[model samples]
Target: MCVSAALLLLAAVSRVTVAVTLPPHTYQTPYHAQVWSCREVLATLMEQELLGCSFTIISVHDDFSAALTPFLVALMITHSRPYQVVSVGGGDDVRPAWHSTSCDVYVIVAKRLLVLSDLLDTDDDSWDWQGRYLMFTSSSSANDLQRLAVTYKLQKTTDVLFFIRGTSDSELAVYTHKMYSKRSLKLLTLWRDGGFVKMVDLFPNKVNDLRGQQVRVLAVNHAPSVFSIIDHLGLLHNVSGLDVKVVQGLGRALNFTPVFHDPGADLWGSILPNGTATGMVGQVHTDDSEMGIGNVFLTEVRARYITFTVPFDFERACFITPAPRPLPTWMAVSFPFTLNVWILLVGSVLGLTVLVPVFGAGLMVRDYQELHSLSASFLLILAQFSNQSTRRPARTPMQVLVGFIMMCGFVVSVFYSSNLTAFMMVRAVEQPYTSIRQIVQSELQVGGYSDFWLAIFQGSANQDVRSLSQKFFRFDNVTKFLQSIISRQGVLLENTKHLEYLQKTFLTNRVGESSVRLMLEECINPFGVGVMLKRNSPLKSSADTMIQRMREAGLVDKFFKEVLQEARGPATQLSSNTDVGAEGINPLTLQHIQGVFLVLGGGMCAAMLVLVTEKAVAAGKYCL
Candidate 1:
């Protein structure tokens, strides 16, 4: 009895059915069952159902989750509604994760069809139930008449077209009258209990909606947008960029197949001395390719050469630089002012020494003998400037003047002390080249792909732009740029959109965000992003219309947001602590102020040497 119950449990768990042909041979009976992936079967049923429709797919197969790639590729090609696929089953409730796709077709698979209908659809008695669905069994339909009845009870009163296998023509005729479709597929493939081969054609290719229209597209193997998408359907195609979504969107709108061309090293087309176009733009200009689309910036110069559709994005051209390292802890002593300011303060002290003694000594010379002597007068003046007193001079006009000199000394002492405290209490944020002038003045070199920035800078009227043209070094390729950017070897000029995306995806993973920053104020020629095309290409208008529809439908923003969300692969968020201290003031240690002490030590040594030399000279004079 336990063994019999175990067989029933196994059949229930695997969504299979079993039956015994004869009571004596029951133990030897085979369980012939058929299974289908809901995604493929449903997509086939509603071939054009997903066209212009946003969709969601739910799969119960945990092992073969990648089966959704074909449907995802279709969405990419059509630029239809943004969609997602999720796995459900294994004792987990898969209810709350269900969100509406809005104008959607929900493709769901479970052990039975009723579970999906309850999750997705509202009952409509008038809806057609003819050939929209299929449920096939192997050679077990005959002896397992009770199992067939159980399946019917689960899928009762539904409009989904059914394809059921029957034992023979006599039994099939009986099954046909049961379902709304009255349709029954014979057990031809299972003739003499044969293996499953050439079992089904998901898409028979009977419909020819496209009549063979073709388009040539310019592409670079950029990631998360247009690169290479491979699927089990033997489809290995490129345009692996989310930016190239427009091409597919337009292709579907205009009914054409896109043929992509690679521009090799040059992404933006350049003008050779021979006056020929080369690069992605070049292909579009010469009609070698119909349109170029893949995160390419639209510029006035390119517009002059060829043509560009109205922009779908606003982007800027800016330079990327490595973030500055932390300032030395010992340097905090002189942090308030430059070395030149220290020199000027010392000179002021000397000037006041001479002037105060000379001006005040004459009037006091008559009253005090200490003031009458030049050396004594000098000492008295020095005491006032030093904010000290050897003897209180007479309260006379000249002495008053000396007192005033002492007050100036107090001001200097307070100023120096205050500045030193401020320096010791705070940190120096090492932001090198925050603005354009700063970048031009810094030793850090500016660089970018020559073909991209040179044209804009060369033709610009702004003096700053023209001056910047003189400073750029040409970048040869992406490999060198990636290495140099993190190491502080070079500052690269690139579009802010692509640069930001690259950081969120690639560079941040390797070098980290602590080492780099994009300078926006230093940006030049902020432009709109658009598809490149020939000067008088007829497809431009249609492409522009499709792009405008995406904008109107808010898909462009949603597409990029989805790309960023999906590509978030263990990227760490940049820490604010890297820039600012925990308490806002990073306390200075001896290391932070070491340079200040070093300069003072050198000054003391020089003074001691000079004093010793003067004493030696005096002793020599005494011997003479």
Candidate 2:
């Protein structure tokens, strides 16, 4: 008894004592437990395991006829976390419940009891031996028990048998097994030396289906999904947002403990050109993990090899491009009006200039004192168009014609004043690449993480996609890529989750504007992302069932609100073409009106040539 107490103290010192929540049970000093029957010793061991062991398992033989079978099962039922039970059968045939349950620890009520020699000859594969906390109720000799311990690699020091020599008649009579044919023999937790003593049989592990199985989960290191952060101690931990929360929520509901394996994003998952899987997908196929959880999109190519659970998030493939650059300085003047408007304005002025003189040229407005040449006439017309007074004959007809020209001049001046005021204020330009087509046409390069996206763009038949592929620049460094985009040097294609993550975590240190200024609305296509696993894995079905439950319960929506807090600040940036900016509208300047000036110069040169030709004809009149 002293030795047992000392050993337990040493074990606790060597290992951290896990605080396992246990069923209500009485605890005794070592002396009392050690001196009791073998059943008491076994019960004490199970209680210790249930209290401190990482996993606790107990098994019951599924034979209703056995005298001590019910007592042992009732005793085993008082267990908690890390504890599980399984039923074993005799050589005749397995029961429906026993076969389905895959019992781990069996308190054998064998029809034809096997000797120790037969147990030693038992195939190792017959039982999935994890070497967990094991205790069984069987009637066997001590020598056979030792041999059984050696064969199954179990502790021989602990007694696994119910029978004990020199114990009272109370142990052998088995009053708990007494049944009445006339009436029901009810038992109320009818057992001795500490175990379950309930009348009705209870299968806790069976009722709760999963039994807290430890599932090997692969959490791929993708931000906003399952981001891996290295602490000061140099240990990696998942600090992902909603996705990790979702996985944790599923784990609790499914009764599975996740042992995360992070090989990082580069080695996450991918379908090679040869149509096989690599990275986490290969790990699952090879049985290293049960499933890979992250933003694993269920594409057709990957679906061929990977089994996906019901999708949790469906998001579009979008781009994170640079801020808008300034407009060209040379186009400032003509930029306010369209080409057709400029042409129409020039034609109107020319038609009016020619008509003024042709319709009323010699109607007494012609006096030698006043200017009468075509050059003078053209200058006077410009003066009227610019709202400046010009010398003219004091003729009623000419006065009336000039008055009509003044009205046209007032409208032109008002149009110019309104258009140029915007540029005079805040001279900013519109963003050049508004759409995917515009981006492809621009000189800037486009790219992002080369997962499957680069291939998608390259293989596309659309001319815009083809052009984007031709000029694509793969991002070697995420920080540099983000900075480059903000500087208006390149455009990036990425998932919304990743883009949002980068915008919050990394872009604060960027040179210019933040998330709102950087446009990310151009989506190629929306793809379904879900929990991924090896093809035909049972875990897939379980995860799918639970994920749907979460969606229906509104748990998924709640998680998104808590985790994806990407709405840092309001964005005043406009996306549509007609949407005006806070900066100002593009204003027209001298460069815009060059079309008007060019025609005026051309007309003056033509007038001078005509006058010279007429003078030459008059000089040769003497010869005629």
Candidate 3:
């Protein structure tokens, strides 16, 4: 009986299913939608296979809960009869700390997919799940998947597959689905499996002997976008007996294949005798990180090891900005007089003080002696007290002294009044005027119509800018509002700095210089500039290319001249911050140098005057 029971227990344990824990439920809508959608697609793709598997969607109902942490999730999943498992959402969640269970499959999603790909798994770890299956996924469905896959140490023949759906139908659909009217079903199948070889070798020099010979040798530069196609075709072309020659920049080649160790070392020289890499190059212009000017050499001479062609010397890049303009003279001057404001204030004070006293005395007037003399007394009082003229009135000496003192007090009062008015005007312009919060309380208008709307949504139409406004602030402008910010009194809630830059670009002393102005105490969220790449690719190399070619060709000088012209043109002016920054610095300085005409003319005149004096002195001495 004991032996029979043991056998049954073992059988039961073996039959137990594999289970997985899903992440928390508190993900933002878009994040939730992506995860759920991925799951939905995955379920549909492998629904039949997952039927008997016990899968649990483990997630926190709230973001603050410690219970939904990856450690706890792992503990829960492992408690059951673990079989195959997939881990998505990488970093600490799937570090080697987690003890490998009977389950073998693992999937990971990277936060910033392309950064630090070198640190990721680079060896063939697929066999760790030889009997089972493991898969990795990344949140960066754009511009990093290929490198991510390579870093994860996934082998070409390995069961692991990488997939990234495009954000638009026009994107991948262009090359994939719509490449051919009625595409070959077999070709489509090959492409779908990511099994098709897609690369081409172009030799501008040698054509015949290398035409069909398999070219295993390839040199890729920083352009990773060109790699996927290059790598795929490289394999096929080599197998087909064609000498495949891939001449490329540095960054792209490193990402495509991980065969070379220590990427930073060098590939431009004959360093790699092992033939893993043919051409190596050092990054050019170490000062400029953005400019793609890798200093490497390449040659076509075939060898058992890597080879390089003579460095493809290209032209240097040129950067430009709007030229400088002569600033308004008054702008540089401190508030002059502000005299009108002071005058208005003084007049108001004097009128109020004099009228109050006259009205009070008029009420006391009674008989003929008082009435007749009162008119004369009033006139005498005015003349003596105001001190308008030196002409003395027929009044007592005491009255003259008292009147003079009163006139001094009145003059001081007027001055005080003027100063008070000037202060008020300055204060009014300094107070809080417009912001996202203030916009809710008041009506506002915006310029750059489309961009203002698009920037808020991350370019998604489902959630409009108004909806975002309502979410952040309760008020809503349901009606389509026109650009009403043109009027001086109207308010504009905007990213002030951006508008400031745009103002210089589009409305500089041109037709619309006064079109828009920033109100006091108004600022929005600060935004930074970003460089975008094609979805599922690395940073585009052209930014680097532009820097290198220009530096080599000395076109950078010509570029500076052009940029200065633009920066100083009448239609546009460069903002102090934007044009003075590194990219635009050269152009801004060039404009100033070109506009030194006044100084040059003044120096010439001084020299001519000295020469004329010397000549006059010589003539006088000779005549004497």
List the candidates' TM-scores in order.
Answer: 0.50, 0.53, 0.27
lDDT of each: 0.54, 0.53, 0.31
Candidate 1 local lDDT, 1-624, one digit each (tens): 001110001112223222212221222212212122222233443454434444444454422233333333343233433455545444443342333333444444333433333333322222221112233222323323233333422223222222234343112111211221113122322211222223543322211222335556777655444565544542336444567676777767766677666665666668788877788777766556667776677766577678888888777888777767767766676676677976876676566556655555556345555655555765665565446766766647766766676787677667767887776665565756577777666666678765567778778787777667777788666666766766767787777766666666655533344446777766887788778876655455567777899889988788777777666675543322244455666655576568778888988998899999999999999999
* Residue 269 in candidate 3, Cα distance off native in Å: 44
Please give the TM-score that candidate 2 achieves against the real structure.
0.53
Instruction: Tell me the tens digit of each residue's lDDT in model 2 across 1-624.
Output: 001110012122333333422222342323222223334534554565334443222222323213333333334443332322333434533322211122233333332233323433433334333222222323433343333444322211111232322233223211111111112111223334444333333212211234455566777666667766655643347455567778777778766666666744455556777866677777776656667777777777766666788888787777776645556555455555667977877777777666666646577546433334555666667777667887765777777877777888777766866675554444446654557887877777777665567667767777677677777776767667666676667777767776765655555432233532445545676778788776655355557878888888888778766654653343223221232446746555565555567767888999899999999999899678
Looking at candidate 3, the ten consecutive residues that score lowest on lDDT are: 1-10
Q: Could you tell me the C-alpha RMSD of candidate 2 in Å?
A: 15.2
Candidate 3 lDDT over residue span 1-624, tens digit each: 001110001123544444554542654443443343344333432333333333222122232122223332343234332322232332342322223344333332333435335324423332242211212132344235443443322311123333333352111110111101122111111112222233312101111112232211322222111112224323211111000111222223322221211122232323243543322222211110111112221212222222222223322111111122333322221122355854754564455345434433444442223213444444434443344453342335433444554676467545544654453233112234333444445444333222233234344343323443442321133111112332322332333332443355443544333334444343333332112111111123333353355447764345433333443444343222222344533322332333245556776998899899999999999999
lDDT of 2: 0.53
Q: Any runs in candidate 3 off by more than 4 Å, and if so which? A: 1-387, 390-443, 447-484, 487-494, 510-513, 527-624
lDDT for predicted candidate 3 compared with the true structure:
0.31
Q: Can you tell me which runs of candidate 1 are displaced by over 4 Å?
A: 1-217, 221-266, 271-276, 285-290, 300-306, 322-331, 338-344, 364-415, 425-446, 457-476, 485-489, 500-523, 534-587
Best by TM-score: 2
